[model samples]
Target: MGTYRFDPIGEAPEQIRFRVRIGPGYGSIRIGVDGIPQEWGWIAEEVADYRGEKVTRWRRSQALQDLEAELKTVAQAYNADHGSNVMTDCFMQAFFVFVESEDPGRLAWRAEFERRRRDRRA
Candidate 1:
């Protein structure tokens, strides 16, 4: 488990910080804004393919897409309240830093994890 922290807006006040806590799986991930945990959950949706077959799929609600969205919302709110011109990209860059830091040996871990999941489904 790792807890990564970064400032959404550069040189912003300490109260405007963000923290991401990641554990073994997607379910153990969490995001915090200003030390207050934000609400996040898994998302499921039905999708139809070209053949018109519909299937339900689940995704991590706070992964890249949802994480960026939530961070943008927070950044927008902060800009509106404080009259600061902070770009949403700043948060994403900081997130990428954390991702890069965790990348070492990640391929092996991911392969093993996927194999275990596949075995369970067999």
Candidate 2:
């Protein structure tokens, strides 16, 4: 497992409030935030080249990092728009959507759909 910490936005230096951890498994990677496990599965799609070469573990690790970065951006956007921090459950849901298609657009659509559903309930 690899652990990483990020300081809160516009906060004092060395003051960290967020943490992300990743654990690699057999053809899968588990992500956790602040010690809470968010999601774990084969989120990255397997790719083949003309020579029938498949994606390597390093590529999968790269994919995990890319996904994490994207999720952070989305979470920041959500916080900015809602004036509140995004919950782990929302991240988990987005991660699940990503696992389904590995497409950021699909994840965005899912988030919008969820927001609309919540608005209807409110």
The candidate scoring highest on TM-score is 1
Residues 15-115, model 1: lDDT tens digits: 33466665354333344443212223235568996889996554433343444454655534433232333665333222211211122134347889999
lDDT of each: 0.44, 0.40
Model 1 alpha-carbon miss at residue 73, Å: 11
* Model 1 per-residue lDDT at 60: 38
Cα lDDT tens digits for candidate 2, 12-90: 2232124333334332233332211113212445678678998522122333455456556654443323233476433
Candidate 1: 10-residue stretch with minimal lDDT: 95-104
Cα-based RMSD of the predictions, in order?
14.5, 17.3
- Give model 1's TM-score versus the native structure: 0.23
Candidate with maximal lDDT:
1
